[model samples]
Target: MSSIKVECVVKAHNEIGEGPVWEEKDATLLYVDIYGPSISRWNSLTKETERMSTETYVGCVVPRSSGGYVIGEGTRFAAVDWEKRSITTITHVDTEKSNTRFNDGKVDPAGRFFAGTMAVEVRPTELERKQGSLYALQPDHSVVKHLDQVDLSNGLDWSPDHHIFYYIDSLKYMVEAFDYDLQTGGISNRRMVYRLKEDEGIPDGMCIDAEGKLWVACYNGGRVICIDPQTGTRLQTVQLPVAKITSCCFGGKNYSDLYITSATKGMDEEALAKQPEAGSIFKVTGLGVKGIPSYSFSG
Candidate 1:
């Protein structure tokens, strides 16, 4: 095992901090507070954070090749004008239902945006299962439903070669791989790559490293685990300061540092007291690995 070092860079008490995209040119990290309904940019060097309310629970945010950002705003794919603090709805999806909302999303190597929905209401041990679906926003601003009957779409990433797509349906307790087509932005040949035991926690957001291993954040497990997708074996473990570690991505100038996000959602006073950094942003350094850059939406 390699020596891992962790630090708390920003004390953002977000309700449900989820999607994190690192912009190299600006030397900043952009992430969404799913329930804060906001998008935030944190400077890596200065540690300064700027947040803008999306007005609706934002599932994720990614830099748009056309400028600004493309956000999963509730049930819609919208364009976010950072400078104007304005949002323009590009299209609405899942218009037939209100029980689900957009959850996690990412851009493909071809510059297509993909996001999935999850049950809107959560009970102690149950949620409206299979009320969600996965969507793709093409470069032309058209919406397409690629997968349906999804319980909780969380993590989604592709292999370094862009041939295998990895995905997580939180309720399923496993990581799934699919044969991917870079040109068509399509996936098939679904298979399980990793499965977590009951005590290991739920898999949440994910990203790939240069070596093609998976760095997965465990929501209730409080750890970011590195897994060899080919063998379904655990290669490394990064224990965070708090449980409910929601998502993670690679950043830093060299793309070696790992930035993690957490959530305080559904935690009672007692639970909250046990982990005061429940909603803070964290960083892991000296992992001795580099990560691929986050793709931007072409449109």
Candidate 2:
């Protein structure tokens, strides 16, 4: 375990703050409060945060190559112009599963948006039900269903070389790797690369570093850990001030800062009282590492 200083960058107290995307051109951080179903932007230079309420649960937001954002909202994907607060539909998926919504997603090296879904209301009885799936939205607006039977489809990213795709199905407590086809945006040869212990917390959202290590936010564990995916060995751990750490991404002047998002969605009043920082966005510096720039959606 490495002792690192964590600072709360935003204290908005989001019910479920999940996605954290850094826009370099604007020097701002973009994230979504899934429960609020709003997209927010925090300016690094001004220290001001602005939010735009959406009509659906906005799970993730990625900059679009054409200007604006490609957002995953509920079962539909839309293009959002933050400046004008306008949205246009791209497509709707898996309409049969009305209870599921997009959870976490990212733009691939080839500029395609890949995201997954989870049951909107996770209940004890639904624990064993495989009610989720993963999909990829191509540059031409076509959607592809890659995986089914996912209980909670949370994080997705690619290896530095773009040959391996790493993903998290939180309900399985495993981090999986697939042989990636960058040119075709296809994934195969799926295998488990890392599995969490019962005490390590449920794996939620994840991102890859410049050196190829995977940083995973642990829900209910109050920590973010660096794991070597090939060997399944833990490299470093960042203890957080609050539990329910939902997601993380690297963003800063040099891309060395690790931005973390957390949640207070299911916490009781007493739990929230103890961890007021829950649902706040946190940043960790001095790790002496950098992350690759996140890609933007081509369409």
Candidate 3:
């Protein structure tokens, strides 16, 4: 364990701040508050934050090559005009079920937008099982279902070589890897790459680094662990000020900074008072590592 400093860059105080993607073109960080039902952009240079309120839960937000942004919100994958704050739903799935919503996702190297869903109501031991699925919106704007019966489709990413797709279901308390087909946006040969102990908390959002290691945010564990996916070995541990750390991405110059997101959801007044920075956006430095830029949706 090496010494690293975690700074509270933004006192966001979101009920559930999740997705975080770096925008290199604008030098800003784009993230979503699932329960705040908002997408926000934090300018690293100016130390300012801009938020866009949405009508429903917004799971993830990413830059689009066509302009504006792409978000997996509610039950639809929509296109947003940030300047105008206009949202045009490109397509939707799982419409038959009203209790499921999109959770976490990212763009593949080939430009496909991938997202998954989970139940709307989740408690410690009470949950609606198998109500969600994973989906991909192709550059051509076509929808495809990759997996079903996903109770909690959370963090997802790919290997530096783009050959392996890593995913987390949260409830499984493990990370799964798949053989990725960039040309077709398909995944196969699923196998477990990493698993967490009961004390480690649920795995939430994740992103890969330049060295091909996986940085996984532990939702209830209060830390992020860097794992060598090849061997399921834990390499580094990043303790956070808040216990409900939701997601993270590497940003800043040379991609050396790890931008993390947390949530204030499910906490009582006593819990909130104990951890005032529960939902703040965090920046971690001195890890001596760098991450690759997030891919954008070409559609």
Candidate 4:
């Protein structure tokens, strides 16, 4: 580990900025402003941002192997062609629960999109009812339910070798590991790989580094903590200017830069005033590491 430099790269004050994915082909970062209900593409060098509006809450976005992006649009899954600015509905999820919405997600090694949902209203008793679940949208356009009884489904990623899956249900204050079969897209043997103390903040979105370490964004914790899944131990922590750290991904020319997203959703005016960078996109460099390139959805 080395001294890392964290800086705010984009100053867009997003209410809830989550789900960051790197588009390697374009050398750009694609993320969603869930509250803005918009998709954003940021060019690191030029610092210019392009936004595409969505009809409802946009939880996550990933590149499609064919073209454009496959997004979790509101209560349904859809495909967006940036060039045409057109969105085509792929499928709808949890239609019976009008209050539930898609939150954080990522494409698995097998090209399946794994996204989870959370309730819009964060009441403690309501959350205790566990109004969330994790779903895997296959390359064939089929959706499969993996886990149920989730409170706040959040961070998700896989081990570098594709044999292990890592997920976060934020309200649980822990990260779960699953035995993943890439060939069949099956997950089993759910176990807690890491647990956070209440004071450490809840685990939100995460990504895996090349060395097989899980880098998790700590919501309301003001940092991203790197944990070694094998031993369930903390490795390093990268401090940020904001407390509502939502998500992160590795991008840039060399794939060593970590791009982080934050939120300003639950802060008071006094708290927001003190942390002006609460909703900005942050970048952490100087860590001697690299990350596996994010896979695009093949469907």
CA lDDT of every candidate? 0.91, 0.90, 0.92, 0.88
Candidate 3's C-alpha lDDT? 0.92
Instruction: Report the lDDT tens digits of candidate 2 across residue range 1-299.
Output: 34567899898789889889989998899999988989999998899999999998888889998999988899989999989999989999878877888889999999999999888766411454588899999999999999999888888889999999999999789899999999899899999999998877999999999999999999888999999998999899999999989999999988999999998887789998999898999999988888999999997
Error of 2 at 79 (Å): 0.5
Tell me each candidate's RMSD, in Å, in order: 1.2, 1.7, 1.2, 1.6
Residue 103 lDDT in candidate 4: 84
TM-score of each: 0.97, 0.97, 0.98, 0.96
User: Candidate 3: where are CA atoms >4 Å away?
Assistant: 1-3, 122-126
Which of 3 and 4 is ahead in lDDT? 3
Best by lDDT: 3
Q: Tell me how candidate 2 scores on lDDT.
A: 0.90
Error of 4 at 52 (Å): 0.9
Q: What is candidate 1's lDDT per residue for 112-173, written digit by digit as tens? A: 99999987867521688888899999999898898999999989999999999999998899
* lDDT string, candidate 4, 185-233, tens digits: 8999999989997667879999999999999999888889999999999
